[model samples]
Target: MTQHQAADTVVIGGGQAGLAAGYHLRRLGIDFVVLDAQAAPGGAWQHTWDSLHLFSPAAYSSLPGRLMPPQEGETYPDAAHVVDYLTDYEQRYALPIVRPVRVEAVHRDGTHLRVETGAGNWRARTVISATGTWWRPFLPAVPGRADFKGIQLHTVEYRSPADLAGQRVIVVGGGNSGAQIAADLAYETDLTWATLREPRYLADDIDGRALFDHATARRRALDEGRSDTGGVASLGDIVAVPPVRTARDAGLLKAQPMFTRLTATGVEWPDGTRADADAIVWCTGFRPALSHLAPLGLRGPRGHLLTTGTQAIGEPRLHLLGYGDWTGPASATLIGVGRPARDAARAIAALLGNA
Candidate 1:
């Protein structure tokens, strides 16, 4: 079609990773366009709960070129602050971003990859898929889950504690979201936190910044042909953010083993103990939102596309960004995405002979 519709590189999902890729592509003087599914500028940040807060400070949580401005009267910026920063970063660079376009699939079209979207089609020599995991909420298959009569929701559907306040609620999973949401609802509801195992809490001094640093060091070690010193996953599951720490110190953050099954009223443990509940909120986590790439046939058994660096191993012309450490260490976080984004852009630029 029109020249405006095609570029040397096309970035899918204009969130933190896409924006970071855009910044580097611009710096490298490569022609590219970013396609975003959302009607607005903020990516998944716009969809987070009102109380969600970054584990790191504003200075640590930022995209490539611009530092996220600190939130007023806040150390760790909240969801709204992150949204504002992402929106501002998108505008400041004037990156050519087309919005409200849902990409249906990506297909191999001869030498170029064709990105099929509801809006139209675009062909590019290289495609970067930054569609983060936010959209694909993973709910574990629990027996009798469908039979549960009370309200059941994933982290994505949760908004305010007032919505489930004063009710018997069980929060599932042991990740950061589980801890944070559990903390938020501890006193507000008759809350029960359930995890697959004992939750690991990092020292209060360790936050996202420390995790990012450790990831960087691990990447360096790997690149240097040294043994992986281990990344954040080696540390702990929870960061012990202010609220989580408060809850833990107050003896409110006790977590029981994940229930073996869901009963009509609530849940039952392996010991046959049961708890009645009005609602169950799952902070179980998410999988990569890669349905668009199904046409490419690159996914492995674990449901992740094989990649070396950010480039898809099976599809050389395609790259995956910000799905998590598989793309790059800490790549899912705001600060951790830049390195991989830059690497992906540089690889694309070199491939296109534009570097």
Candidate 2:
């Protein structure tokens, strides 16, 4: 027999965003279910390397109502600490989460949304898609990549530095992961970072405080269109100079040009540069995983689900929390997801009342 559960709202992806949304829905008296693919919560943080830690300070990383464990000074928490924190948050809020059940597809049937998961089927008046940015790691297609004899893997598969110990590593991409991994592997093996853009580095602190504030400020400016810049710029482009130059001088890592081809032993860079590597870790970032939703006409030309100004485009019952620019830095951070979740819960409640 097929069991079907119904709710006022259904949130997909039980990461920080989905958990936060479920918490808000419960507070608003909206019957909701959070569907997550993982056995537990914490999103990608749960799967990251053992040594991974947030770059932002604890003060900025606290979720609403619940604060991170008291840590003296401004320090980032490791991945394990974050997972434990999220687990605690779920228990405290008593948020209803359906775990280890992968959401296969979502479709709108008249006024309701139908969610099909590996566990079962669910129907809800509304849906909140809170899947975070790192759901799918983007790896650029390169010629001869399959022919490479060495192991090639995405950052998603990386678990710890021990996996690469004593091996020559090529960490691709210039983002935070690329930089951090290369730095961590410095004492373990020969490391190289490759990217098309010249690398810019930021200092660990700004004016005696963690420099994440600068990132927050820039993100705010970009989202509000208050900054003189027309489009988003990389974190390295906007940060101050001293930190940037200092990081470059550290010499723990250096940037290589873009990848051109893959050889049996390693990669070939454009400028005819080539290096032998025993392993390559692609930290190329991710895109929203909405392929299961292709049947619905929701995505934009850029492949993102087009929202009606920050909300859902055609379906008022559908909402997207933690999407960039919808609220601010909160859209990108675990702590920031609370507000959107609250709003989404309210929206769902109101819709249910009318229905």
Candidate 3:
């Protein structure tokens, strides 16, 4: 049942990044196909928790060519709205996406990159690895993690507060996800939010639009050889999204210092304080989903590819998109992804002698 397909360029992942690259590829008349592991469109957005909302308005969080249509009566769209937008974007652009084809590995085959997938294989002059970080959720290895008898889960496995209703739950990590999830569980559960350090909240007015602007300015300053202008991180750790703001105002979003270890029943701090919990939710973030590219021998000590912009330094024919700022400033966001995707597509076109 395995067959071989060929394209001048192969774009791995059909999510926002992949779709953005596809739009540019189509514009440039590049012969390429997008390979998505998902059974349908929407990509990782389909899997987010029910209560999750964007950090900005729909227009501010759009993809390459089209703006995500605003959800009715909502300033910030929820996860389901994002899914609908992504699904519609795929159809609007008519990007050639092969579904449910998980890429297992990518190997160098002579002058071409051979993308091995569950459904088939693709041979391409160039490959764009846009398979983003959602597949690789990171859970910190706290001491006694294995001994913890209570329920444990990462943000990826979390769906809705209903799943943990009435439980004494500890939500871990200081990032946006941790804050949001803790907010989601605030009313439904006995919630304890924990962070490695004190949580930093941005100005109440600051949202994804402001973050994107700051990130763009930082990138501009870097490119112009000026002193670092600073990006989103320069402001604060968490954007005061609506739910998070409400939770904070209600005194339900207070964060505790991260516990040193997990016990069979709960977690304990170095100060000899212990709190019992029915479950632990790890909002600890994720690593880049780059396991498929391991065969290329490109990752470094920290398990990240060295890149000149979006193109891999060790492998020029291979490009990475939408991981984080290293790929491109704010490249992981919907609006942020378009710039890098275009750059990647243009690079592939130039490499293939089409540009």
Top candidate (TM-score): 3
Residue range 1-355, candidate 1, lDDT tens digits: 4332688899999998999999999999998999999999989999998789999999999888789888899999999888889888989999999999999999998888889999889988999999999999999999999989999999999998999999999999999999999999998999999999899999999988999999999988998999988788789999999999999999999999999999899999989999999999999999999999999999885789999999999898899999988899899999999999999988987888943
lDDT of model 2 at position 75: 62
Report how far off residue 205 is in candidate 2 (Å).
1.8
Q: What is the TM-score of each candidate against the true structure?
A: 0.97, 0.87, 0.98
Candidate 3: C-alpha lDDT? 0.93
Q: Which stretches of candidate 1 lie over 4 Å from their true place?
A: 1-4
Q: How far off is residue 15 in model 3, in Å?
A: 0.7
- What is the C-alpha local distance difference test score of each model? 0.92, 0.72, 0.93
- Give the higher-TM-score candidate: 1 or 2: 1
What are the per-residue Cα lDDT tens digits for candidate 3 across 5-24? Answer: 99999999999899999999
Angstrom error of the Cα, residue 252, model 3: value is 0.9
Alpha carbon lDDT at 341, candidate 3: 89
Rank all candidate structures by their TM-score, best first, as comma-separated numbers.
3, 1, 2
Give the Cα-based TM-score of candidate 2 against the true structure: 0.87
